[model samples]
Target chain A: MTDLKLALQEQAEDVDKVLDDLLLEPEGPEAQVVKAMRYSALGGGKRVRPFLVMASSRLFGVSEASALRVAAALEMVHCYSLIHDDLPAMDDDDLRRGRPTCHIEYDEATAILAGDALLTLAFEVLADEETHPSPSVRCALVSELAKASGMNGMVGGQMIDLMAETRELGIPEITRLQRLKTGALIVFACKAGAILGKAKDIKMQALRNYGHDLGLAFQIADDLLDVEASEEETGKKVGKDAERGKATFVSLLGVERAREQAHMLSEQACRHLDVFDRDTELLRAMAQYVVNRRS
Target chain B: MTDLKLALQEQAEDVDKVLDDLLLEPEGPEAQVVKAMRYSALGGGKRVRPFLVMASSRLFGVSEASALRVAAALEMVHCYSLIHDDLPAMDDDDLRRGRPTCHIEYDEATAILAGDALLTLAFEVLADEETHPSPSVRCALVSELAKASGMNGMVGGQMIDLMAETRELGIPEITRLQRLKTGALIVFACKAGAILGKAKDIKMQALRNYGHDLGLAFQIADDLLDVEASEEETGKKVGKDAERGKATFVSLLGVERAREQAHMLSEQACRHLDVFDRDTELLRAMAQYVVNRRS
Candidate 1:
């Protein structure tokens, strides 16, 4: 790994610790749900979303601690999505990040409640006095996060994915599906940090575009990994999408074509960072990291 | 229905139209997910949560329009909980409010996504400038909604219910479960509107207590109806809890005893409302309405 990559990895660890700290629920009637939420949220993962928030905020000269809450908030939503996605009703997966899924670890009802709690907690974290100092900026973050996570964003994409499972999907259809399902929150993560960091409107737009491209690239890479990675490497069952007849880039496009598409998207994503100053080496590295990472 | 009930129902219908108007998705790839969200959300049902918000705000002399978005938000979270609860892995119910459950009507993935979207949108509605004037108020509202909806609140209660499915639960355990699961949000709904209406903190606490008693009464009545009401009247399959071996008040205390308990809770809710002055007639009536409603 390059020095930038190594530094980000360290920061990623810090982000994970911070995320765990924020998710700790007070003892109460809902303590079990809180425990389930913390279990899934604190489970080991790449922390890519939080990384993006911190990295993007760094571009605008904001301290990592200043963006920490928003970073944790992004991870909370991501974790919630994963837990729900792993439910018997959704993707029906039994394992996630190399462990029994939330529903399997806890009961399905607890898993559902856990996901719900985490999603609500994300907004609560963002609305905190420390993370959101200015009402206008906080409002902007709330709107952006909502639009990205809501029906017109991540949830929408998942719906299309469900519909596409039994149907033949074209490259355009697949891209569109991934954009909403996967890309929306990644973009939102960056944009939310930018809003908190008080980046100029134009710069925020550029970072958003960067996130948008990066998100798509990440999705394409995930498709690639599903075919190439081992269970140990990906920490998930590989080739399950193809086995399930789920429409994915590699299944729709040949492996060679999918690899080429991922590269093209990564280049486009990196180009978006040109709008930012040299301090955005972190963003550029993230683009390259998306396509190159083994998992 | 009484004259007041008829008028409240008409107002609820108008509010339902507003809900439909507000939920239309701006065009994007996420439209279908938004559509499913709209389907489950706008799917015909009693707008009780919104009614509580509107009624509580009205108690404080705020116009319905001023509390319009807050009302919608309360409904959104309520709808979200219902959708998630109806999942195959959760309650596994096939129907809600006399309609096919979200997971049943629109595939499981779509239902999960729809519920997730609605939960996020609640905060979005609060944060919008169109809803309230002050960010501080919006911030408080967001925090209130989140705390009420998350672990130690609705979701937490759900976890307990799931865990206690076969295990015997006493009155205190059952009461605690119901209080967190249903009572918390209703309490927050009243408190939220009162906060938006700028009610003093002491008044807000009293209204919240009123909501708490009403919520408990509502749950006990629901437990009663599960035993007494016909499937058509209740819009839910009768004897579900009994079939599932679920512990319920009626199951624990017998039917007549459960009815008495509900009456006591409703009366307690009314006594809490004595502090609200003459304008609290509607709020008091709502408490009685909780125990008296057939469905």
Candidate 2:
């Protein structure tokens, strides 16, 4: 495997370990929610968000331990969103990462509570003194993460997506939806390092720009994979977007054009790294890997 | 109306105004979630949590403006929990505060999104500089609120309640469940004033003790109301615990014994206020009003 692939796997494992240590088995009747939380959060997918957090933090010479905690927190938020989105009242999916979804594995109520608890835990983790020595930095982290995942961001995007199921959306509308849905969190991950290191304005802006292009490219690639990849390759059911008549980049731009756009965005995302003198080769490699991967 | 009743009404109106101003109508496609949030949060029943926050803050001479912001945040958390708990997979209630529950007024997906957004907004509000001048204090508020509402507190209590529906729970287990579920947040509300004022250790402990007894009394009162009150009086369905065969204080202890317990606890709760000579007459009146309330 390439260096980026190895680094990604290492970071994923590190984050899993942090999450495992943070979430303890319940000794009371409420064990069911904790079990559901574990089921959804542990031993899961690519951990792409955690990888971005770690890579970005590394650029600023942040301690690996601090970065891992933030990564774990971000992953918890991401996992909670997935668990809720897959509930019977929402996407109603039975499988995720080739395993039964939280609601399918546990019960719907437990799934809901688990998702709520995970989101709560994410904020708790960020607010804790262990995340940062400075209270101001911790507050900034909390504010940024909350904004990224809250009504104006991920949740708002999900609402729009749910309403758009029966309506036909144009390319600009689809782009806006994807940006809010996935781009916001990705931007937070990339900018988190700057906040942690107290980086200057120019450097912070560079990472933000990089994250913006990379997130769009990543989503476009995901759209392409949904159109072309099989369940075995993707570890998830494919073509559901088409079956549900969901408007995606692939559906709007065609396979060839969508792929070209993703590639162009990935290259543009790499150009943002020119502002940093340190080794950003791994980040550049990630941009290419995100667009090129089958899943 | 009595002094306590008048004070409660005034505080409720203040919290409603704050919540209304904070939650803006959406200008985008995601208006559905924002509408659901407003539906559940605005013009609701007695703002009990907000009242507790304001009353507690008053002990420390915390500014009403600052206290109101914290109260509004706590109410948002309470509202979010109600929205989620009333979902079909959970309590399955049709009515809340004399109107349809969030899911009944809106779609299930919108309700879930609204709940998620409300929870997120609670943290964002607490983290903002407007909530507190010191970042450390804001961080403390966030940490306390998160712990009170997360897996080991309210969410954990909810899980136990869900599981206990199929199992028999004794009085001790029930007390523990209630303490975790509802008592935690109440205690936080009471202690928030101390934290904001940076009260002395003895004073903080006294307030915490007061909160503990008062929360239990409040829960008992709620259980009694569920057994005795009408739909119109409570603004919700009555006798749900008995209908579901869920164990509660009223079910374990006879109605007469439960009422006696609440009265005893209320008196005991007021004794903890002896450490302060700052005209705690309102808090003493609140204790009596809580147990004697018809709804």
Candidate 3:
């Protein structure tokens, strides 16, 4: 395997460990919801957002423990979104990450409660002193995470997405939708390190710029994968975007143009890291990995 | 109106204004979710949790603006729970506070997104500096709110509630469930004042004791209403627990016993407030109001 692949695998294992620690199953009937939380949040995904958090934090020489806490919190939020999105009322998918979806594995009520608990847990983790010694930093983490995942961010994007399913969307509308739905969380994952390290404004801006381009490139690649890849490789139901008649970058730009755009965006994202004097090879490789990977 | 009733009415109107300002509809397709949030969170309910936050804060001389922000955040959390609880997979109620429930007002997808947004916004409000000048206080608010509402608190209580639909629960199980579900957030609301003022540990414990009993009294009264009250008076469909064959304080205890229990709990709750040597007529009256109110 390539160095990027090895690094990604290592980080995923590390994150899985932390996630395990944070989500201990308690002794109660409510343990059912926590069980669902563990099922959906563990043993899956590439941990892309976590990778962004750690790689960006590296630039500021942030402690591994602090970065990992934030990374796990972000991942919990991401997993919660996936659980909710896959509900029968939403995407209605049976499979997620090659296993039954949360609603499918557990009952719909349990799935809903699990997702709610996970989202709430993410905020708790951010607010706790273990995430950061400084109260201001912890508060910043909580505020930024809430904004990225809240009304004008992920949830608002989801509202737009529900609307998009019923109407044709142009490039601008689709771009905005994708930004809020997926890009906001990714960008927050990148900027979390800046808040923790108290990085300079200019450096934080550079990281944000990099994250914006990286998020778009990642989504475009995902759009392509949904069209081209099978469920075995992607570990999720594919081509459903077209089936639902929802607009995506692949449908709007065509696969060839979309591929070119993703590659160009990936390179631009890497260039944004030049603002820092330190090594950012991992993040640069990540941008390229996002566009070039099969899944 | 009686003084207690007038106080609840005035606080309700004040909370509604704050919620109205907090939930401004932005110009975007995403505004659909915001409108749903506004519909469910504003112009509804007695704002009992907000009342607890403000009344408790009055003891510490916390600024009205600061207390109002926390009250709004807590009310937002309470409203979000109502929206989610009334979903098809949950309680599936069509009416709330004499109006169409969130899912009835908007589509299921929008309702889910709106509830999720409101919950996230609550955390955002807590984390912001406007809630308190001290980051420590802000962090405490977020942590306590998340703990009260997350897996071990409200959500966990909800999980047990879902299970209660299938099996009969005794008083011990029922009390534990109620404490986790509604009681946790109520406790958080009352203790939020102590957190804001950085009150003594002993004083905070007193408020907690007060909240614990008040929450139980409030819920037991609600159970009695479900059994004896009408839809018109309660502003919600009555007799739901009985229809679902779920165990409740009223179902387990006869009406006479339940009524006595609520009254006893109310009196005990009032006694807990004796720790403060200041005027606490509002809070004292509130405990009685919760037990005796018709709606």
Candidate 4:
């Protein structure tokens, strides 16, 4: 196995443990909501966002405990978005990661409450002093995460995506949509370590730039996969964007041009990492992997 | 007008302004969600929760700016809950505040996204340094609010309420449900002033006792309203508990007994406030008002 893949596995396990400890079931009828929270949040996905947090924190010498807490909180937010997206009123998909969606496994109301609970729990975990000794750091984390995930960010992006079904969008409009929808949280994950460490302005800027280029490149690759990968390999209903007539990167740019664009963005992302003096090979390799990986 | 009513009216105005300022119109298609959020969160209800925060904050001399910010954040959470509750899978109500519900006005997707955005924005408001000069106080607000509204609190209460539609619940079980659903946030509101001031343990305990009794009394009064009030008087659907065969205070204890219980608890809540020597008339009157008010 590759070194990056092994490191990602270790980080994913660490985040899973934290998530398990945080989502304890209560001894009441209401424990059903927590059960749903546990079901969707546990044992899912590649944990890419958490891995980004772990990798970035390593560069700053942040403690494993603190970094894991932030990673878990972020993963909770991501999982909540997915659960909401799969609801009957939203994308209305039955399957996610090769299993029944939250609303399919549980009732719609339970799934809604579970999504709400997960979102609420993310803030709770970030606010806890155990995440950081300094209250300032905790407050900063809450502030940044809120901006990235709220109306002006992920939710706002979703509104635009829904509107896209009825309207036409150009390249610039699509770029803005993807930036808010998916890029915002990815950038947050990459920059979270610098925020925790209170690093210098130059280092923070470098990570921010790297995250911007990497997030767009990653989304383009995801669009490419949606067109090419099968449902069995992707563990989801593939070709969904095209089926829904959504204007993804590949649809607008065509496969060849879009693939080339992703490659160029990946190299540009790697170039931003040169600001760091050492120990950047993992982050650099991640840029290339986003464009090259299958499924 | 009564002094308590006057104070509540004033506090509501302050909170409304803060909410308006926070929810700006973004120049994008995503602005539709923000519009929905503003519709549901602004210009409605008695703003009783914000009134509680303002009244409590006055006791400890917390700044008006700080108090208003917390009140607005609390109201955002309250509004978000109302939006979700009125969804088809939940309470399925078509009207709130004598007008179309959020989902009735906007599509289901927009309402869901708006609710999610409001929930996220509340944490951002609480974590801002403008809410308090000290990061510790901000963190405390975030932590306490999250606990009050998350899985084991308001959301849990909603879960139990949903289950009550199918099950037979006695007084103790119903009491637990009410405590989590509506009472927890009230307790937090009553105690927020003490937290912001870093009040002594004895003082915090006194407010807590006051809040616990007051919260239960408030819920009992609410159940009574549902039983007796008209749609025109209350600005919401009447007798939903009875229609759904859900157990409530009036359902379990009868109207006369529930009325007596509300009065008794109101007086008990007032007595707990005797810890403070002066300027508590508004709070004291609120205790009586909860039981005696017709609408």
Candidate 5:
């Protein structure tokens, strides 16, 4: 694989270790549920959002541990969203990442509780003083994640997506929906790292813009891949969007235009890195990787 | 209505007003979700959890406004649980408080998002500095809520409940489950008030015990009502436990024995309040109401 692929894999492994360590505890009555949570959470994935957090935190020359909790927390919130999103009432996809969804592996009720446990656990992880030394910083992290994950952010976007599936949506409406649904957490992942790294105010703001743009680009690329990539390549069922008649960027703008938009957004995201002169190669590469990713 | 009934009605009205004012915001994409959330949270009910928080805070000489956010937050978490519990995969109850449940009123997906929103909003309300002046105190409050609402707490208990419904449960096992599921948050409610009010450590522990015992008693009484009360009187469908074939306190301990257990638990809870030299009249009255109320 390329150096970029190796770096992504390494970061994914590191974040996977962080997730496993954070999820461990002595036995309890609900140990089974905790085990179920770990089963879903620690199952290997790309770990893109956590990587963004770490990469952004590195930009400000901060220690990796300071952002580890936030990184894991982002993954927690993301995993929780995926768990719920894959439920029968939501996207109803049985397979995710080459495996059965949480609800498919566990009962739906267990899946629901597992998702709830993960979401609440994210706050608990952030609020732990041993993990996050600064109360203000912890609060900031919590606020950011809450805003991204809640109705006004990821969940709101999801509602719109659900509605848009039943009816055709224009480009503007689809973009707005994807921005909230998929992009909100992406922006949050970068902001989480920026907060932990204590980046300069101007740099932080620019990073926010970068994340917002990258998030949209990432979703567009995902939409494009859903239409273009094979199931084996994507590790997700291909053409399910078309089957459901969902309003995705590719569905609205076609594969060609969506690819162009992803490229443009990636450039916009990389432009924000110019504000930071130190250790930005990873950030720039990540922006490129966002659009170039096959899965 | 008696004097106690009149007082409860007034308290309920005041809480509704506070809820309306707190949830009110400018119209936007989030407005509809927020509206559904407010509609689920603000309607008529006992508001027992918030009352516990408010009354306990009063015991420690905190202003109502000081505890308002905590009160509202406790209610939000409670409402979220009810909403999720009413989902198709869970208990699938159609009616709550004499009206269609959130899932019944809205689609299951909307109800899911609505519950998720309320849970996130609980933390947002607590984090709002206007309501909670001390970041440290707010942090503690957030941590406490997270613990109560997460694994080894409410969610854990719910999982155990779901599992136990398929089989028999001994008294100790039932108590343990109830303690985590129902009792943990109730205990946290009282303890959170003590923390916010800056009460003495000894008082905090005592009030926590009080809340814990009260939670068990309250749950037992609920089980009793499920077996004995009518739908009109309780505002919930009667004999749901029997219909669902779930093991409740009444199912395990039988009706008379469960009532005796509830009485014993309430007495123990009231005994904990003896550590504080204050008018715990509301506390005592609430304990009595728990056992005696038909609905």
Candidate 6:
């Protein structure tokens, strides 16, 4: 296996352990919600976002424990979003990662409560002193993550995507939507290391730029996979975007053009890592991997 | 009007203005979600939670601006819960605060996103430096609020409540459910003032004790109202508990006995304020008002 693949696997396992330790089973009538939380959160996925956090934090020499806590928190938010998005009132999906969605596995109300609890837990984890010795750094992390996931970012992007099902979106509109939906969280993950290390503005900017390009490339690649890959390969239903008439990067730009654009963006993303003199090979490889992967 | 009534009215108006200013209308495809958030958050309610926050903060001489921000954040979380709980898969309510619920006013998808955004915004507001000068204090506020609202608190209580629809619950079970659902947030509201003021442990304990009794009284009052009050008076569908055969305080205890319990709890709640020789007339009056309130 390639070094990048091995590192990603290791980071994913490390984050999974942190999440497991943080989310303890509750003994109560409401244990159902906690069970649902564990079901969705501990279910295996690529953990790409957590890997970015670990890789970015590694660049700044952040402690493994601290980075892992932040990664776990990020994963919690991601899992919560997925749970809510899969509800009957939203995307209404039955399957995620080849398993029943939270609402399908548990009842809808339980899934909703679990999602709400998980989101709340993410903030709680970030605010805890165990996440970082410095309160200011923790507050910064909380604020950044909240902003990235809140109305002006991921949630807002999802709102747009929901609306886009009825309307045709051009390339620029699709790009903006994807940026807000997935790109904001990616940018926050990359910049989290800088906040943890108290890196200078220039370094933070470099990571931000790298994350921006990489996130776009990643989304484009996802769009391509939805068109080219089967449900077995993707571990999710494919061609839902086309079925819904949703405008994605691939739908706006033809398959060949979208693939070319993703490749170009991946290369451009790697160029931003030049600002860091050492220990960025993992991030560089990640950019290539994100665009090249089938899923 | 009585002094407590006057104070509650004034505080409610203050919180409304703060929430309005904080939640600005967005200009984009996602504006629908923002509009839904505003509709639900700005919709007229008693704003009792914000009033509790203001009253508690007044005990510590906390800055009004800081207190207002915290109060607004608390209200946002409350509003988010209401929105999500009223969804088709949950409580399935069409009306809230004398108007259509968020999902009824907007699409279900939009309401869900708006709720998610509002919850995210709550943490963002608390973590902002404007909420507190010290980052540690902000972190504390975030942690406390998250704990109060997350699983094992409000959300857990909700899970239990949902489960109780199919199962019979005794007085003890009902009391525990109410404590987690509504009592935890009220306790946090009261304790938030102590945290902001950096009050002594004894004082914090006094407020916590007061909040515990007061929250129980409030829920009992709500249950009584549901059983006795009209839909117009309550601004929501009455007898939902009985309609669904849901277990509640009123169901376990006779109506007259439940009312008596609420009144006793209110008086007991006020007794906790004896520790504060200062101006606690508002809190004392609030306790009485909570039990006697028709809606």
Q: In model 5, what is the error at residue A191, expressed in angstroms?
A: 0.9
lDDT of 6 by residue, A239-284 (tens): 8888888888888789999999999999999999999999999999
Better of 1 and 3 by TM-score: 3
TM-score of chain A of each: 0.95, 0.99, 0.99, 0.98, 0.96, 0.99
How much is the TM-score of the A chain of model 1?
Answer: 0.95
Which of 4 and 5 is ahead in lDDT? 4
- Global local distance difference test of model 5: 0.83
Q: Write candidate 4's Cα lDDT for B1-295 as tens digits.
A: 9888888788888899999999998999999999999999994788878888888888898999999999999999999999998999999999998889999999899999999999999999999999999999999999999999999999999998887788899999989998999999989988888888888888888888888898899999999999999999988899998888888889889999999999999999999999898868888888888888766
For model 1, what is the alpha-carbon lDDT of residue B27? 68
Q: Is candidate 3 or candidate 5 better by DockQ?
A: 3
lDDT of 1 at A292: 92
Residue-level lDDT tens digits of model 4 in A174-251: 999999999999999999989988989898888888889999999999999999988888788889998999899999
Summarize candidate 6's per-residue lDDT along B70-175 as a digit string, tens digits. 9999999999999989999889999889898999889888988898999999999999998999999999999999999999889999998888887889998889
Each prediction's DockQ against the real complex? 0.63, 0.87, 0.92, 0.92, 0.61, 0.90
Instruction: Kindly list the per-residue Cα lDDT of model 3 for residues B164-196, writing each as its tens digit.
Output: 888879999999999999999999988988999
Q: Each prediction's TM-score against the native?
A: 0.94, 0.99, 0.99, 0.99, 0.96, 0.99
Q: lDDT score, residue A162, model 6?
A: 87
Off by over 4 Å in 4: none
Give every prediction's interface RMSD.
2.1, 0.6, 0.6, 0.5, 1.9, 0.7
For residue B124, model 4's alpha carbon misses the true position, in angstroms, by 0.4
What is the C-alpha lDDT profile of model 3 across A10-126, one tens digit per residue? Answer: 999999999999899989788999999999899589999999999988989899999999999999999999988988888789998899999888988888888899999999999
Q: Candidate 6: lDDT of A77? A: 95
How far residue A236's Cα lies from its native spot in candidate 6, in Å, is 0.4
